[model samples]
Target: MLRGVKREVCLSNLTLQHPRPYLFVTAQCDHRIFYGCWRVFWATYHVIWVLLSWVLEPWVLYSSSERVKWFIYLTNWTYLLLAVQAVTEAVNFFCVHSLREDIVADQQAVPMPWYLKLQWLLYNIVTTGSFMVTAWYWAVLYKSDTEIGAVRVSFHAVNSVYVLLNLFVTATPTRLLHFIYPVLFGVAYTLFSALYQLGGGTNIRGEPYIYRVTDWSRPWKTLLMSSLSNFLAIPFMHLLVFLLRLMVGRLWECWRGSGGSEEGETRRGRGRGVTCVDLGQRMTESSSIQAELLVSCE
Candidate 1:
């Protein structure tokens, strides 16, 4: 009877130690940096991006054309860098999975859990989608004026699609999406901000939260804080952009009026004397013809 009990105990221990087939897949699927420090870092990155895109670009737009060109160049490089980072992370995920067998016994490897699989899928979608949108936006900046509008539309559409998809994919009755929504926004804002700042592109007038370097404490901290700040700041940023655009419009109008007044005064002074009048009349006619010619060319 004692020997029989010893054998039963051994069998029970073996059964308890046996690994499930789905465990490996499930672990892989669920392995995401969603909680704690990861989430904090993610949030910070986005907040910076948003601030750059919405604020810095517009401010820069008021600067010289040479500066704008330099800005655009910076943005393109930044987007490419970010895309590389995302791809690297994805590769790391695969690398870990490949070595799973060595880490765990065959019996313990379980199938992938549904939620973990979903998370992985969403990660791929968001990263790829963001890369594509940012790349296109940069490309458009270099292209002719005619293509810029279309490219802008495409960027917005892609962005909307990804954001909505994220919402749908993560949605749960428990309101898990709410907790994660802030995180996602932070991520998007960071990406968007980085692209905007590096590209030298300004935010759309109605959009807000232009990224600023001063807002960040350090490189990594900036990335994380910017992302996290999106939850509280994005709406305010939007309002700020709107008001800023209005102010910009007023300033532009004033500048245009001043320029027009100066030109009119110069033309009138040139119109005063007989020979000068003839020259002025001829010049006026030439200017009219030039304007017509330009209009036709357009």
Candidate 2:
């Protein structure tokens, strides 16, 4: 069976069924600590990225002769995603605290806004998948950019993994279809790049292409083939996240014995972990109310 919560951690909404819901305990039940840690991590990463950008090349920043990239550009988008996660998780952490304290446990359930829920889902999907794509593309196809020296290499390769690993330990299992948002995010960026090229907007090196493969100077056939291939890569990255969540969730359930017994029966008799409830009813509840996700698992 999975170990029970420690003093700082509490598990809620634990049920064994086709679609299981279990809360991940945060490092703290307090909002301040949660927010403080996020700020620390954010500050550390931004400092490093800035130092690397300065060392490697100054042009990536806004003051350069290059066009001013959107605040949503490049690594900044993932940073925004992280910021959103920090805010949402901090609130959820406090909510879980209230739930455990029995302050809100019996109160009438207040549903979260649909957009807020959607934001959480997209935060997981887009942030992780986009960073993965950035790293992979730079490693494989981004030859026209300066040979990825140490700074570029770290930004693309090692730095992207920060969000990936963070989400791995923090996120709950969301449905597979929500992955479409990440695909849309990639397509939107590609469309923006195409428009920028048509307008003759260039990068720091004053190159017409944002990342080289989409260079306007490329033959129509070459660009078409490359764009198509790259578009397909987005969904693959989404699937990678899906599989990672599934593996992590399953491992957690098994280790905790949160699911039914190895024989697929409820373990209520043993007074251990699993408790068999009516699977049919649980499915209906998950589909309706429980799936709303009132708090972060962590």
Candidate 3:
């Protein structure tokens, strides 16, 4: 019977079934640090950074040769997705915080809404796509003489920082199976590139291709690059994220257990080090709420 509960708890980490809805809106380290200030500050910073970038993008584009074609770039698309994710994240946090009293008192599970699920989907895409954009741009598209401006850095490099920080800070769970979102996003962009070529679209300099590597004029080369990015790169990034989440969770558990009361530690019959089952049982014995939300055994 206990094995069944542990199995269920372990499986919950891989699925979108996060029973404790409150965890979605809270930061992973919020309880330990400055009470809850970290959540507010981080969420506000995300909102401000995205808003500033949105305002600057137009000015930067118009000043450069890209002009209206700026929106067609993958960097900008990922940036827009990140902006939406930030807004939705802040909204969910505030909404849940307002209902904290009722949610805590009743302990009733709130159903995850469609928009929140959409936000989670966007999170997966933005995180993976942001890193891809950064790596691809620097490795392939960057030119020595090209001007390296703040806006360009924000879109390419800093964007990855946002997603990486989000990975470690948020209490959100990442699933290995949900890698399909980034794969689909990559496929959609690849399809759009082909359609744009057929439609006689051109880049800023009126070239036939948006990027040299994606030039549809060379059909075989374009196809190869598309397949590599959509299949190979996206899946690799998602797997890295999934592993990082598990490692971070393990470190968090170790840190918390070290500071736990001596009586609580004695009750668990373990100190800092613990096996998977021992950790699961310890969490289960300590707090039923935590057991439902925190267990991530494999």
RMSD of each: 31.3, 9.6, 5.6
Residues 111-185 of candidate 2 have per-residue lDDT tens digits of 333433544564555455546656556665666845666655555665556556654455344444445566666
Error of 3 at 88 (Å): 1.1
Compute each candidate's TM-score over C-alphas: 0.25, 0.61, 0.76
* Candidate number that wins on TM-score, 2 or 3: 3
Better of 1 and 2 by TM-score: 2
Order of quality (lDDT) = 3, 2, 1
lDDT of each residue in 1-298, candidate 1, tens digit only? 1221122223222211212322212221122343223333433443345344434444466546434433333243333333343343344344445665532233323553443344443443344345434543454434455444432343334443433332222211111112233245346647756665555554433222243441232558666655434554433332332233223323322343344223332311211222312322322211211111111111
Arrange candidates, best TM-score first. Answer: 3, 2, 1
Instruction: Give the alpha carbon lDDT tens digit for every residue of 1-298 in model 3.
Output: 2332343444445445554555566565544234245545655665666566657645455545456676677777787787777777776666666756543232435666565577788888888888889999999999999888777887788888878877777767676666788999999989888888889998767898777888999999899999999999898988787667655655555555565434344221234454444444433422322333444576
* lDDT minimum window of 10 residues, candidate 3: 283-292
The Cα error of candidate 2 at residue 39, in Å, is 7.6
Worst 10 residues of 1 by lDDT: 289-298
Model 2 residue 279 lDDT?
21
